[model samples]
Target: MRLALSGVSVRIDSSPIVAECDLTVEDGERVGLVGPNGSGKTSLLRTVYRALDPFAGSVALSGDDVTTLSQREVARRAALVAQDSTPDFDFTVEEVVAMGRGPWLRAFESTTGGGDATITAALERVRLADHRARRLSTLSGGERQRALVARALAQESPLLLLDEPTNHLDVHAALELLELVKDLERATLCVLHDLNLAAAYCDRIYVLHGGRIVADGPPAEVLDPELVRTVFGVTCTHLTHPVTGGLLLAFSPQQPVRSPHSVKG
Candidate 1:
């Protein structure tokens, strides 16, 4: 599948949050969206997933414009793992995963034995099968994040959109989720805060700044020290991970680097 955002712009309260941005995820490719806080990474995502419509440009899935499709058709084409929780209906984990099948349900066919199996498999894939009976609201923040992912997994869509999926996960869980993303044969556009994780898992990375795409390319090319220092306002040391061979971004909080010539004796 292919996902494309062409010169998309999003606004809230009649003010633009994202502007004229074009991005793409080709078949079986994983793309990362990264930027500083309030840079509008999520705003672009919201446009693609149809939670927010773009006032300009277009979002297309497999060459078909999303705005032209019905809501159910859109859901069948793409699944979103958003940061915030869905409205709480006091559902269990199993129930939450099963709800993902709603888009596929036929009229008057509310439940099925196969649906239950699908839900079980989704939970198991995320290592939450044992917690299936637990209340969705009661899961820890990380666990809830996993449940959200499990819901998207069960949707079985060819296009995946994720926003901050690893926000609250522990190290192991975070890695586990990224591994799942890497293994999936789908077009993925994910919003990620952890640059190292994006470098490790994503095939390409796009950096947004001031609501524009400031930089984009392979992780190795886009994550240079100069770009990191300028766009992120921090110093960085770039190196390859000897074990996995991915880019590792070591950063320092914004601070002045004293020059020898400027130092007084």
Candidate 2:
């Protein structure tokens, strides 16, 4: 699936959260959205899944306007993995994944044979097949995130929207989760705070700032010291990894160097 946003803007209760933003995630591509806090990344993402209608412009999936599609139709085409998707109820992992079949079922209809197979396949894809009976609340943070991804997978949507899937995870877990996402090979639009991780995982990146997109391209072309200083107010050093030869960034506060002064006794 292909997602395209053209001149999209978002407002909440008369407060503008995003300006006219244009972005695209092609079929089977992993595109990353990165910016400082409150830059409207989440708001833009919400528009794609029809969670929040764009105040201006259009969001299209496979060239079909989102407004023209019903909520269930949209749900059938796009799946979302939100940052705060943890359930309060003690639902079993299998039950949680089964919810993804909702868009296909009619009123009061339960999942049948094929639906059960799909749910099981999703769990196996996330490597959670053995824990299908476990309560979601008892799983580790990374495991819970994977379960959510499994739910999205069960939705069988070609387009995926992920809002900071690595939040609250340790470094190793974060990398593991991103690796799993990369392996899915879905058309994904992901919001990420860690620029390095985005660079490593995303095929292309769009940089948002002040409710507008400032730069976008492959990670090697868009991420640079000057852009980092201007957009994030930090100094950045670019390095190449020895093993993978991927881009790495080291950042520091943009403080001035001070001359040394001697103190007299």
Candidate 3:
């Protein structure tokens, strides 16, 4: 299914957070959302997932308006792995993953054998099958994040929304997670703090700044040094990665790196 935000805006206490944003991700596309801190990436994602309502405009999936759908209907359409997910109770990883099936389950109903198979498959996809018996509180930061991802995968939605899914991962795990997303046969909208990772995995990108989308294009066109400086207030150099052949961003310590091809305008 296609995911789209058409001139969507959100406000809290009369202050706008997401302002007239419009973006589209075709089926099976991996689209990245990147911006500096507090740029409303999460807020926009919340609108898409129905956690927040848009003050103006709408979020639509496959020509159907999301606001009109019931919560269960929306849950069946979009699965979200939020930026900050913490389990308060001491639930086992298997139990936590099983929660993803809640939308499809009737009240007082238990997980069936088929549900168990799906949960296990999700955990295995994230390479966390060995930790299924562990308690949520016992897992490390990266492990917890992967468990959350497994839960999202178990939802089995055609559209997936993720907020900094690699927040606490080491270099290897981070890249591996990106690879998993890249290989998935679903439309994915991911908010990534690491520009290089987004460039490496995403087929296209939308650059948000100050509550609005300022740039949208392929990685090579959108991640230029001048645009990064203007939007992120950082000085950086861009190079092509040897292994992946994707754009690699290298930062300057005290001074901005100047290159002729660097569009600073």
Candidate 4:
């Protein structure tokens, strides 16, 4: 499922959060969204997943305008793993994952035994199979995040939107989750804060700043020192991994050195 945002903008309480953003991801493409905090990366993703309607402009899936589709229809096409997951009830992890089949169910329908099998499969994919019967509240932070991702995978959607899916994960768990995402042959738009991981996994990247997309291309072209400084307000040196030949960012707290004549007295 190809996802596209054309001139998309969103406002909450009369304050604009996402401003006229235009972006696209082809089928089975892994696209990363990255920028500084509060740069509207999440907001833009929310629009793509139909969590919030854009104040102006359109979101399309496979070239069909998503606004014309019902929420259920949109849910059938895309699955989202948000930055946070908070369930008030003490639902078992398996039950939570089964809900991903909601879109396929008839009105007033309940999950079937086949649904249980699917849920089990999803949990296996995220390595949460052992925790299937466990209460969601009893899980650790990383376990909970993995469970949420498992639920999204259970939805069986062609397009997946993940908002900081690695937020609470330790370094190993973070890489494990991203590795899972990389292996998924689905159209994906992921909001990621780790530039190195994004460079390592994503096929292409879109750099958002001040509610707009300022850069889009391969990680090598889009993640240079100038772009890093402009978007993140940080100094960085780029190095190529010997094995992968991909860009690796080495960060520094100090600013770039000025040329002799350009230095002010």
Candidate 5:
């Protein structure tokens, strides 16, 4: 499914966060959102998932206005695997995954056999099949991240909203998550901090600064060293990766590197 944000602005307690911005994730594309701290990347995602409504303009899914749909209706179309989304209590892994079916369940309806099957399959997809009976709180951070992803998968939504989905994972696990998302046949809007990973996996990228889109295009076009220095206030050695032939970035602080002997010793 396609996601379009047209002239969208967001505010918090009367303070503007995101200005009128136009962005889109074409059908079956994996789009990346990248920016420095406080750049409103997460804020824009919240607006897309309807957690926070835009102060101006609109967000549409597959050409339908999201505002026209109820929250449950929206859940049926978009599943958010956010950075801070954790279960309130100690729910079993399967139980947590099954919650993704909330949008499909009617009031007073219990989960049917097929629902159990779906949850099981979701766990397996995320490689957590053996942990199905484990308490969600008992898992490590990376394990927990995978379980949450499994929950989103169980939702079976066309548009997946992921805000830093690799936060708690180690390097290998982080790469694995990106690979998994790339293999998915769904539209994904992911907020990523690592520029190299963004370049490796995203079909396109949008850079945000001070609540507005500063630059956007394919990873190579948008992640130029000059743009990185300007927006992120950091210098980077940008190059084509020798192994993957993708973009490679090594960042440093804006100031010149200090020599150990130059400092008072």
Candidate 6:
């Protein structure tokens, strides 16, 4: 699936949260959205899955306007793994993953045999099949996140939207989760706070600042040190990873503010 957001704006009550943000994730491509805190990355992601409607502009999935589709139809096209989406109730992992099949079943109808197969496959993909019988509350943070991803995978959608999926995870768990996401090969748009992870996993990136998209391109071109300093209010030294040969960002506390266009040469 191809996701296209044009002139999108979002508001909470009367206050604007996102403003005229335009971005895209092509079919089977992984795109990243990066920004400082309160920069509206989550708000922009909500618009894609219709959790929050855009007060202005349009969001389209594969040339069809999202507004024109019913909520169930939207779920059929896109699956979202939102930040902190775990249920408060102590549902078993299998039961939690079964929730993803809701769109395919009629109200009050039980899941078909095929749905069970899909749920099993999803749990396997996330490496949580052995834990399916366990209550969600017994799992660790990383395990819980993987369970949520299994739920999303069970939805069988072409497009995936992830909002800060690595928030509370340790270093090993974060890398494992991202590796799983990358291997899925779906059309994915992820909001990530860690610039180095985004640079390593995402094929392209969009930089958001003050509720608008300020810069976008491949990671190499978009993650310039000046751009990082300007948007994130920190000094960054760009480096290459010795093992993976990918972009690595070394950040320091905020330095004297400099204009993004300032040239040292």
Assess every candidate by TM-score. 0.91, 0.95, 0.92, 0.92, 0.93, 0.94
* Model 2 regions more than 4 Å off: 112-115, 256-265
lDDT of each: 0.86, 0.93, 0.88, 0.87, 0.89, 0.93
Give the clashing residue pairs of candidate 1, or none: none
Top of the candidates by lDDT: 2
lDDT tens readout by residue for model 1, 1-265: 8899999999999988999999999988999999999999998998776889998999998899988988888888899988875645988888788878888889876643434777788888888989988898888777777788788888888888999989878898898778877776678999999999989999999999899998989999998888988888988898878997777888888778789999898
Candidates arranged by lDDT, highest first: 2, 6, 5, 3, 4, 1
Name the TM-score of candidate 4.
0.92
Candidate 2 residue 56 C-alpha distance from true site, Å: 0.8
TM-score (C-alpha) between model 5 and the true structure: 0.93
Clashing pairs in 3: none
Candidate 6 lDDT score relative to the true structure: 0.93
Query: Candidate 5's residue-wise lDDT over 1-265, tens digit each?
Result: 8899999999999999999889999889999999998999999999876899999999998888888888998998999999888988998888888889899888977653434777888889889989988899899877888888888988989899999999868998898888877877689999999888899999999999989998999999899989999898889898778998888998888997788989885
Q: What are the per-residue Cα lDDT tens digits for candidate 3 across 17-133?
A: 989999999999999999999999999999887899999998998888999998998998999888777667888888888888888888898864444888999989988889888
Per-residue lDDT tens digits for candidate 4, residues 209-229, read: 998899999999999999898
Best candidate per TM-score, number?
2
Please state every model's RMSD to the true fold in angstroms.
2.5, 2.6, 4.9, 2.9, 3.2, 4.4
Which of the two, 1 or 5, has more TM-score? 5
lDDT of 1 at 94: 81
TM-score for candidate 3:
0.92
At residue 39, give the lDDT of candidate 1: 93
Rate residue 19 of model 1 by lDDT: 91
